[model samples]
Target: MASTVATNLNTLGRTTFIKNPSFKATPLNAYAKVLSKFCIIPSIEGPLKVVQQIEQQGAQTVLETVGLKKKGYAVKSHTLVKHNLATGQTGQVTAQDVSDAEYLAPVTIGSPGQTMNLQFDSGSSDLWVFSSEMPADQQQGVQSAGNSIFDPSKSSTFQRTHGTWSITYGDGSGASGNCGTDNINIGGITIKNQIIELADTASSQFLSGSESGLCGLAFPPLNTVKPTRAQTPMVNMISQSDIPKDSELFTCYFSGQSGNSYFTTGYIDHDACGGATPAYSPVDSSQGFWEVKSETACINGKAVSRSGNTAIVDTGTSLCLLEDSLLAALYGALPGAKIDHSVQGWVYPTDTPITSIPKLEIAVGSNYFTIEPEYFGFADLGNGYTYGSCQSRGSNFPFDILGDRFLCNIYAIFDQGKCQFGAVQRTSSGATTSGRPVDSGTESSTAQLVH
Candidate 1:
């Protein structure tokens, strides 16, 4: 019966169109805060293994806290690992893990509508928040950061649930919490009975930000609820009877400039793309991501072919991560471009002429979109070098990640009902390179680049 239900959900189809409202994304500008949000990508096998370990640990912890034990359940041995670029070593460490969150949106929850800032993440699928249920020390940290905490007691419609959830990222940062159901509103769209994870414990990293929580836009299977998986807000939103049949998709527009980024649901902003229609590609959600295949990339207007390169359209990530071979080919064409081990990523001399930088492009199905040269220089290294926005995924990570660096150049669409990913180039002058310029004296000296 469970298998049948899952199959039916996966095979649900989209119907015709209706227009809906959009929400603006608030860009974070504090250099220190932005640096703290850099995402550390784990090796190919690391995430799955870590997730399995966390699930088992979370289930065990929940049982112990509730004073209940399941028959024949045993804890499995597992270790959380991350690469230390500064030390050139792999080590076991517990640190505040950071997600690649650059933008935030205001979301309202509960009956009377308690609004809080939430980082919208397409790479993850759990809607979690800092809550009053956490330890006093943790609550203090959240307060210090000026972030709001969800007080379920204040919400008349809040309903407590039996499930618990815990999740650890590749960077060893994690959050564990109890579950509840409430009404959630985003951009004038309301989703009833949305599962909300209220954190009882959170790593210090999450407590150091203004954002109170995360609103995950990924597929339902990635939700961390235990004993029974719960649907994400996006899933619930689509399932709502009031939502228009045509509005089962969402679109993201990152202008690379502050105050201009926003997202729309149930409709596409064709004006943003200068009336260009998006080129669509089938999405493979088996892995619970917006995954698609890319076989070609362009360097200096020259086509470079590579096969079996699956890419994830992840807005949660800040940089564009490509396969090693493709990265080498792209960087090799530029003189003095090298992967600096100190930073553990590619960097070029700050004095390098922008005209000398080769034109770069990545394909989405049959459509190829150009990545502007300005985006190539991601950050200044303070020592006469600038970091490259496009980096290698290393030999272990199995797929390419088209993150914000790529998304800034196009209008991206995630059609859940149709199981498709779409993109169209943004030719408007309004779209600019990401990141505001800082004085050379205050430039970031070290980068936290992990693979």
Candidate 2:
């Protein structure tokens, strides 16, 4: 059944369309012969073994560095399309359903340029993708899921840096590959000689999804590549003078409804924020992740006390993570909600009434963002709860995770230059009020941030 879900992801990837021409990719079969020929670069049996050996070697010895890149300067913005991959295991997958689960953007790589849908992550720093080295069984989703393997052998400008890279997620999922340099293009903006991680071994989690790779948008200090660390595509563009110095920051706005969600590089899209003035908070980039102060949280007008609570605005994470103490206090107001060790979080009875769920609001600086009941009830446990057995929105993590589950309510901007984060209400799509009617007293007619 899990493999079937993975297969469905592949089918969804191939058929998804992008509104932008630059990020549009050719069909997989269109270059099958070329990719097949390139497959000879890494012998099938040795790829995974090589990756394991590299991991065991402890640290990599610097061999040699090649090519001093020329800088290109210009202020520009490329609009990215948000793609949602559907897996049938979930109930009634819709634009809103998966919007909070995963967010993917189309990226073009190599000379002839093959397009791959990659997750834009703000927590880590390393750009990696499925490549010719991926085993056949794991590459099943490549064709239908819009998952494409990068074949450096086919690109005229591809340069092998002979470096190894590896990344492991908090859930123990990981990928390892060889590093190289290639031309990467997004929404017509091109970043020449961008570092690319070609995965030779991928864990089952990656193989089971439509995302072909990840574009880490966080600070460069978090990169895991070996020999020498590689810069993120965004950092490369910014440091190499590829984007206008004045407009180097990027902004992301995710809308849960049919309305558009976009990732704009180099500038902010004010219209996407629904005309709401952004309330900015300083981010602590010294630790690699986009860390910010989450002053406090309130439930039903009662304040929840927390000490030194900080938040990491991570788009890659599907659910919001909070400390165990906060989780207890937050879910205490709701009936039938208990910690489910099996899922590693709190779960509520599927039959619990929506009105029984209390409102949750968190403060960032002086601004407060509220999440309604509909957004808080995460997913239904398949054992017949349908709408009743939903996971608690809060999970136990070392620090607070402001993930897509909470982020989709506002337009989020990460300004690398200013070292600050800003968020505003998304205008086109109605804020947190979903499926349920809004209470006239607590809800505003127009979506906007409150102090």
Candidate 3:
């Protein structure tokens, strides 16, 4: 049977507090995609619940959710809608589709307050920070967060139950845990009593990378990970408690500013970024990723159509990629772009960089957006390896991922409650073209490299 839960994140108030779009210099968000496990697993054990007691402050049971993204199907209701391809395992969407979709904030391990780093993800939803006992596999080169680590032992309401959960990202990254509890914090706000899946394996890159464990603050019916497929931590916590009932929408503003970024609950300081909150499209949850209902796709201003069903909006991703047909429609416009079946992805000659590719625009709820060029480019993939949006990943590529490089010039807002994304023009405040507060735009063209 298909598993599911609901996200209590409903956008209630729409208000701004501060506007500081001017920052000295900030870090670029890396949304690298790696392969991950996709096939579904049996239901996990127990009726997912979050119990905060003395022994363990808070612990959340993650719901195992998985899907392979490709050319044929689409997620319409929790059910898969087969398009041209029948019995196809994966799904697909266009570049513009993802840009206009609503998304959840990258949650960290800390109290509601004290949220240090917030990550925006498109591959996985099992948002969790690490606990002190995190197995050596998880510890690895990563040291303990010390005071920041969710100290389950400190919570008087800690409960030990058999909570099994697993997450395999589209990028081949994953983490798993039996069950654990620590103070679950989000946006500097505390979920007083809660439970989370304690990752016991090598989660160093994710857990302590910057903030605490992640928070899958998106749509729910979270993935059921264990043998009995139950509710996930976020879903169960909101369901079991009366806290979210008073809320019509739990909105979050993920400030992807250079540093000092945060997850603002209830209110988003639109002025803080000197950016505007564009209209957000309702979210498509059946696909397991942030999917938006789009009306069009135009290469540099020309219109096009897509054969796939969903678009994966990933901040962790780097470029704007598309499926075979849609890409053909795009590269056809460029001077040197073609599909290389040998490599199973798209490729373009270095002779041409921009392909003069027009701004791929996606429309949501009557709002039209033009994806900027900053999202396209060749990057050092490792071993001096490099690739470009004009290129494709080998066969079985994740097909479509609207990465951060595209949003640097334009503002993208994830309004989760409305199940929509907000896109606005990215202004520099006359700052540096390097996305820094300084003046660097004079050095080169407006096309800035995220690296």
Could you say which candidate leads in TM-score?
Answer: 1
Candidate 1 regions exceeding 4 Å error are 1-100, 428-451
Q: What Cα-based lDDT does every candidate model obtain?
A: 0.65, 0.56, 0.40
Off by over 4 Å in 2: 1-101, 135-146, 170-172, 257-259, 349-355, 382-397, 426-451
The residue-by-residue lDDT of candidate 2 on 87-128, one tens digit each, is 212121111212212567889999999888887878767788
Q: Summing lDDT over every window of 10 consecutive residues in candidate 2, give the lowest-scoring window.
A: 41-50
Whose lDDT is greatest here? Answer: 1
TM-score of each: 0.78, 0.69, 0.59
Q: Where does candidate 1 have its weakest 10-residue lDDT segment?
A: 1-10
How many clashing residue pairs appear in each of the predictions shown? 1, 10, 78
Q: Give the TM-score of candidate 1.
A: 0.78
Q: Judge candidate 1 against the unseen true structure and give its global Cα lDDT, from 0 to 1.
A: 0.65
Better of 1 and 3 by lDDT: 1
Query: For residues 1-451, could you state the per-residue lDDT of candidate 1 as single tens digits?
Result: 0001112222232221111122212111111122222222322322111222333343322112222222233323233344454454555433233332567778889988888788777876879999999999999998987779999999999999998988754334668889999998777777899999999999876787557888888876667788787897767767775344654777888867554788776666546556455677888776567878776677775666655667878877677888766777778888999877555567788898988887777777656677877677777877988878877664334567788878888878788878888776764365422121111122224222222
Q: Model 3 Cα displacement at 73 (Å)? A: 6.0
lDDT of 3 by residue, 333-364 (tens): 66655543222344455445544644555443
What TM value does model 2 have?
0.69
